[model samples]
Target: MRGMTDLGPLSLSPVMKPADPPGEPLPGIIKTKVFKEEDYINMPWKNGLGGTKQIAIHPHTADFETEEFIWRLALSEVRDSCSFSVFPGYDIALLLLPEDERDGSASVKNTVHLRRGSLTSPVALHHNDQATAVPLRPLTPYTYSGEWPTSCKIRTGPMRHLTFIANRELTRVTATLETICLHGLHDDGECSDSDEAVHKAPGEVNGTKKDATGNGNGTALPLGDECKNPMNGNVNKLLIGNYSIVYVVSGAVRVTIEGTLEPHTVLAGQTLVCERDDDSSPTDLAMTPLRKDGRAFEKESEHQDATVLIIQVNILRPERRRHSSLSDVSSFSQARPRGRSGSIIVYDDQPLPPLAGIDGDTAASSAARAVAGPSSPTSTIPMRSWDSARHYKPPVFSSRFKNESEVPPAVVRDQLIIDEFPVGAISTVWINMVKQGLSEWLRIPVIVARGKEEGPVVGITAVVHGNELNGVPCIHRVISDIDVSTLKGTVVAVPCINVPGYLRYTREFSDGKDLNRMFPGSPTGTASQIYAYNIMEKVVGHFNYLIDLHTASFGRVNSYYVRSDMNDAASAAMAKLQQPQVILHNSGQDGALRSAAMTRNIKAITVEIGNPQQLQNQYVQWSYQGVMRILSWLNMFQLDPADLAPAAGPPSSTILCSKGYWIYTKTGGVLEVYPSVNTVVRKGDLIARIKNIFGNIVDEVYAPGSGVTIGRSSNPVAMAGDRVLHMGVIKREGEVLAREAKENY
Candidate 1:
């Protein structure tokens, strides 16, 4: 392969293959083509959005409008905030580069705020939540699903970027910008290691930025002017896939494949494409930076800077198999009753899972059976996993509550964990959750409303899942509106409990662990566990009753609903007072904050407000009213005159359900959930549909049983194992469990 200096299209040699391959290129000498600046195709973007500079495609003449290529690359220009074009079924990777030589101030203002699918969809939110931004360090490659509605806001002047899109079904692509100092002293004094590269160049170093020189993974060798000619050691090794591309981001580099006898010199703006055999182990290469004279950079020489973008691609790699896009269940053989709200619909499809039903940790296959079994069941119709659940005994709270380990609730001495029940005061304070990295602390904002008269402490927490924000305003309003002078009890509101997740605007904690599932966490465990333990010990322990406020996670929508154990008189009372459209008699999901609170003899219930990442004022008002009603019932406060009336509309059709489960997608595609929140449907009714990028419907979801929709997936983009619809079964009016629960509780 020749490295060309002239900007002209070179004629093909007789043995050269087509630039675009039909499928996987046939086994032979690797073929590649370079597009000169003059040959690059520049045109208006899709929908006349903006301008695009393009080169390199699988189908040399593939149409981006039709999304017909296996992969495509483009360079885009941006200045301020910008929205990215949505491309279905393709995985997108981007690299940020400077518009020109930059200064120190630009570094601070150049970072970009990136978001995918508006709220990171169901999978990203569940699996990889983070709030950190991608800095404008030139050459750092960041990737996301192409179909997601992605956008970025730049803090500074004009910037240019490289956008790479690869077909999810046919290939894998990854790019890393590395700073290589082939010959520089590892120590402060003299020559040391041969390869001292900042492997994670122009980007994050363990999710943090160290300096402007790009020493992400390791230290960049110090280079001085005094040292001159030096000896070359064994070169740094770079692993490659079917195609290994070396694009010189800055300075120059001397590159040579292991088998090649001669080395080639590549200049800045030039990209070297190397191809090897299919399914072969990554190719090892000798790569070294070059001096201005084109010779290898010497140890301690003035050749202090060199950066390269190494992009690897594999052909014909099949995409991962997704959960079934649709699942079917036979008719409900029996409808059993567990409580006033519990309408247990026993279907033939879902099997019994483990007896220990965890609220937040259930996987796709066992999702339906994860709901907490009733404290006492009237259901003659056996539910899934009931055989095992019948053998398990519930935790009995004594005078002093204890966890499963029997660790007594130890009153903590820390300033925030311990409370001073001051009379007639409303106070707001920030409590540290955890220390991030070296110095940053993620803190929770707590609002405490203490009444003049001593009474039970009620804890209200919101945003346990970062994106679930509807409850945030609801908590704030209740705490602010309450009259502490006349109130009989204390009210504590944790507006944003999962601070890292809230800041990141995703569903999970900073470490990507679902904080809701790590309750009563250990003092020594994973990050999420430690944080969870702290909340239980420091914040939650202060309350005698807990109202864990919530909303839908990313890519999902929910109706106002309450999940509470009807067996508990106080919890059930709180649930009914919320005025939710639906009440599911879920004792509590294990590991859920509400459930964890219950173990401490703290009456608890979970209140789901609405869709996430938004302040739906209507839902917020409803939630505020619900909390106020609960407070009034507890004799904590007198209700406002205006709140005496029910919600704005005709009283909502509040349905009571015994059990619920989320249906999952079988495959990946664009999805449309047909059922709206609170919609009632029968076994054969259409619930949702999925379509391939070409617009042909690939899958259709039918209702598994007659039920009211509790919540469902909202994002149009779908992947296997993502949510479909939350189905809540309806019980006959005046069921046997309803009469028995009131008497027993």
Candidate 2:
């Protein structure tokens, strides 16, 4: 329980704290102990839901009022509070904001200020037309009970879209350009040089026909009779080779050769094949065109939306060949998905020169003059799901919380629960986890150990920055003297992950690595990466929940408290259980250990105690009890609520950071801050000031917002445009419940 002395008054801006001594940048990420609060501006309210504000609409009437040329934006002051809506227009966006009237209906106000080119929406009075107007009262609180309209209107620019017309009504067209097709991997059967006694099965070239002149020239040819078309037969398919496979996502086509009376349609349910062969028939083989006038071989516009696949085959021929092999016949290579074969292969109208056969036969030899027709095979390949590819294993020891027996009588009898516990009691546990070879020997130790009893495994780890000693001592005390034997479950602790930096009292490890930022460790990396990987994979990779502890460095100071992303259930539970002097929710940041842990489904929070290098007994006591309270909540131990004192002050309603901004000094100088964290400030309020080294006034920083300050710079000295403070604003509008649930007996 927090006593009167443990709590600090809440303010609008962060209290100025000290800075860390100048040091080298750590190789990895480090957690900063200072609390920073800043300002956030005109965030938007979309249908009562919070989101980015980018719309700007002009009201159709003059009754509503709103800020014009908005400037110097900031957060609101009242905690978790919202004010009246102030704009109006036709439909809702068409009117300016309004003011509440005694008659219970709101009166139209004025137009809102806006930046150029921003898109705006108009509320619709009726769904059928663009010009109808709706009363603005529905947009105000009393009428809608402070609820925003459920739907918003969208308006596009007044421009016409272009349309294109084709000379002919083509059955199908492909919008996206085809991907470049390179020669594919070679793994098919080899080719031979001489046609020497090569007899292909009759169907291999059956029903082949070629329309070389686009006049359906050879449609009367008999099955297996070589046609005059140059691109027919098993030979044409063989030329494409086995390595390349193509999927015709849509459209249809029929393949035929010189001697076929009918063409086979390569449509959705059909398969066609053309192959390369080494048959050395002396007479030149006739070839067939797969299509005529860009349409399927012999069919009309029947399967425009059909799709098919084309796979290339590899053919290796032997050495020694003749020039007849190259010519044989000419004309027709380009074919469209829906027939259309008018694309000429112009290099004098010839296909790519086939590779020299394995026997070194040049293009000059062994020409097979026979035209094989349309009898080819079709195939289908299965597709895989992308979601199933992202599955990952849960962390080690993934288990739910279990109830445990009460704390031992000896611990209660010894007054350990009542007397102020010492700091650093659990320090050795961290060291022991690493020292005992239980944790990965990385720059950041990710280990957590549970007590013997059946309580929750509260994460007690320190050195998010290797040098912060306050948590070190506080944890040491909890583990050393506390009767863990009576405690339920275990108190998982990691004393020093940055072992090298701790000895020097610096923020980074000796290798210039920071332990905090290197979360979700990499599988392959530098020493720091490996360490991070090992820790997460080994230590932290095993726990279900966590608590990362920190303190102000030698140069700074901070109020004792706990940080949480109250949006998370586990985090909220920890914050309430710890019962710190002040519970600051909305403290989440991406890439932090807490964020990473949460991403992996781990419950976690960051606890910040007192600042400065000094160890205050009360602060230490607060830390101890907070841990016990957490353990008690987890059923690791039991304690009397009656013995506990009321929290330091009325629990401030939880404020959310709808938006935030940073304030930097214009010139390097000495800085002084006015508003402190939790202190509410009015718009345009002065938040800080700057002075030269000689104490000459240089500039004064005013609040760009009207919300409470959650954090600020602790260092007094600053450079031109140096960050001097941070602010956040509450933009939520509606009834806010001020009650919170606590662990009850």
Assess the local accuracy of residue 516 in candidate 2 as a C-alpha lDDT between 0 and 100.
65
Per-prediction count of colliding residue pairs? 7, 131
After superposition, candidate 2 runs with Cα above 4 Å error = 1-455, 480-482, 553-555, 581-589, 640-662, 728-745
Worst 10 residues of 1 by lDDT: 399-408
Candidate 1 on 1-745: residue-level lDDT in tens? 0111111111100111254433444443444444444555675321111245665554344334432445566666553343455555667766666433333456325534332112221111111223444444444455667556544544444456766777676666655555555443232312234334422343335654232222332432212233264333223445555556666656676676656556667766666666555534555565566765455544454454566666676655322211100111012111222111111222121234446333444363244444534535777876544323233432222211100011111122343542463456555567777778877766677766667787788888999998998887787667546666687878888888888888888899988998888888999999999999988887898788888889888778888899888778999899988888898877654678987898899999899987878777666777788888888888888887565454342126678887677788899899988777887889999888999999999999888899998888888899887888988877667653342221010
Residue 531 of model 2 has an lDDT of: 56
RMSD to native, candidate 2: 36.1
lDDT of 2 by residue, 1-745 (tens): 0000100110011111112232322222111111112211233221111122111110101011121110011111111111123111101111111121112322112222221122442222222222453322211111111122222221221110000111011111111111100110011211212222122332123433212111112323222233222222122221222112222222333344323344543322122332122341121122222331224233222212222223222222222111102112011111112111221222111244443322224332222111222223552543221111223532221000000111110111111111122121111112211221445432333222234445555567676675566677567545533444345555666666556567677876455766566666576755555556555655564456777777655434444556677667767888777666445554444445666677777788777665544455445556655666776777765654532445422233545444455667777788888766555678898888888888888888888768665456677867786665555555457634233311100
Q: Highest TM-score: which candidate?
A: 1
